[model samples]
Target: MYTPRTPRIVAARRLQRRKDRDQSGRFLAEGPQAVREALAAGVVLELFGTGSALDRYPELVAQAPEVSPVTDDALNALAETVHPQGLVAVCEQVDVPIGKALVKQPRLVAVVAEIRDPGNAGTVLRTADAAGADAVIFAGDAVDPYNGKCVRASAGSLFHVDVVRSPLTIIDLLQDSGLQVLATSGAGEDDVDSLLDGGLLDRPTAWLFGSEAHGLPEAMLAAADRRVRVPIYGAAESLNLAAAAAVCLYASARAQR
Candidate 1:
């Protein structure tokens, strides 16, 4: 049983702090969903601090009763969120084995490339879980999968998803698998909604979304089996990465149903 430390942890108040995330390689897991998922993932809970409001998750706390309880004052700085969820855990990042990363035959996959934002990456993961997408592969230049903010943004879905990271060329893998490598383009041959419903995604498909500022690299755009765009009718310049992921993944969900 781990004994509780009284003095507070400094600089780690905000979950987004690089030191905090890097040190734990797990960051802070807060809220019911996040905490539940982390527990399911077999994350090593260094410490779990909670408030009376969250007595509802006793079963969850049972996973680690030695977990410390903290007042909002201590929890606030630890999480750095405006409203502390009353439950937070310092956990070790769950690592994925390379062999178990990919399924033998995945009909649908979410390929996240060059995605820098942790929140966006986390949300995409959540979307993948909800859509029952086969897997999530992080190509080169993606954000840390275990970023606290991302974990929080995912609302706990990361625990259920199969996330993989590989060095092979992403398009090469898809093409070799005979899967349609569709990329989300700001301006493309087909609109996103039309293609998703029209059958472009009917086969084994890999959906890739790029960085926000610059859509996708030219070479990658060229390699796409096809390109699809999400239409914007409102005054918004562009949809945020997480929102766009939800839209794209939901399209696959609709098709599957």
Candidate 2:
């Protein structure tokens, strides 16, 4: 069993930092769900689990070629959550280029533009996967999709979709692929439901979501085919990035299905 202070454990812990993750071209996937997904994605380099966790999930252990049993304390030190799920894995980064992702001719794509919050970014990725989005583009200065909190928030869906990081050029790339890029904005001129009712959502679409603090920038809004607002019938000022993305992506998913 690797001790918490062992060199391998210390090295894995460094993955929690963006610089370290970038330097190593690797990141940590903590908990059973995230680790399982990482393993299934065929990106896991090493799998570490507590003895109990290894016994509890024999299926995972059987599938993993490089498995190590660790003490509970060692597992806790490696985990990011308050309650560690006793399993974690070191995995390679899987994000591909925007052009490669576009080659799939995705029916639905989620474009996250400058979303700073890791949780929000992760939630959006998870929601996008659930909505059957073929790819997720992290455009502008968006947070790293491999950030530990983001990975945790994604609940394993991170491995289920193509995640790409690009600049504002992502918008042009998405549009050039024959997709109608719609920016979700509070001041949007078009209503989401109205567009859906009008059959606009049935087209190959990409939904642009902005940061939590400020919505989409003016340039982004202008670049989009149209700006859409998720109707606020409840009198709540506006939906958060995750909620807005869920509504928009699901609308497109249902429309296309």
Candidate 3:
């Protein structure tokens, strides 16, 4: 195998400009697992650059058509982490379609609003893929679904699931589509397993999750046909966003089967 040449410059400076990602429609996805996931999901890789670990990933690289070599400093600039992985990829946006098809699907769906954290947003989408949810929608000022950390956190589910950035309210979308909406309120009034493994999966469902601090927007929950909570046996006040999503989506899938 031929050795790769490194890029000329190593950019230590963090380019915090707003339009950089928007302009390129690309973001930094770090780590081999993240890279493998993206490749498996069929994301259009604009560029793939690696560091010292390239030799360990001979098989993964063999699968890749070709890749550019990058300096650690250049990767550090774009990385969400301090100690960067040896590999980072620039990927094009995966635009998921919306409208009636979203509402018509038989699988349970997840919706997020004001989830500013890219990692959490990615987790929800990743959950959607695992639990076979029909789709995911980001309502209001949620994080960009295409953010690199989001994509990486998704573990490449960004390739399999339909993720929509919607201007319309989840309630309006639900109402128009004749879906039963469930909002996770953490109130512990009802159980999710009984709901899903029995009847909720029979009907088209849309699940809503909101900001970590604010929870679901009042209007969105008010429109919900049901507000459910994950039962707690422990003293923890809440669940991590990704964990909560995995539980919810899988419950719906188990119910349907």
Q: Judged by TM-score, which candidate is best?
A: 2
- Where's the lowest-lDDT run of ten residues in candidate 3? 7-16
- Cα shift from native, residue 231, model 2 (Å): 0.9
Using lDDT as the measure, what is the rank order of every candidate, best first? 2, 1, 3
* Model 3 vs. true fold: TM: 0.81
Tens digits of per-residue lDDT, candidate 3, 1-257, equal: 11222332221121223356656655556778877866675563533454565666766676665566655555555566667677666555665656744645546788988899988998888888888887788888888877666777788777777777786465876756767888888773567877865676567778888877888888877888888887667999888777887787788777767
Question: Cα lDDT of all candidates, in order?
Answer: 0.71, 0.90, 0.70
lDDT of 1 by residue, 197-247 (tens): 677656677788887877777777889888877888888988877678778
When summed lDDT is taken over every stretch of 10 residues in candidate 1, the lowest stretch is 1-10
lDDT of 2 at 221: 90
The better candidate by lDDT, 2 or 3, is 2
Two-way TM-score contest, 2 vs 3, winner: 2
Q: List the residue pairs that clash in candidate 3.
A: none
What is the Å distance of residue 20 in model 1 from its true position?
6.1
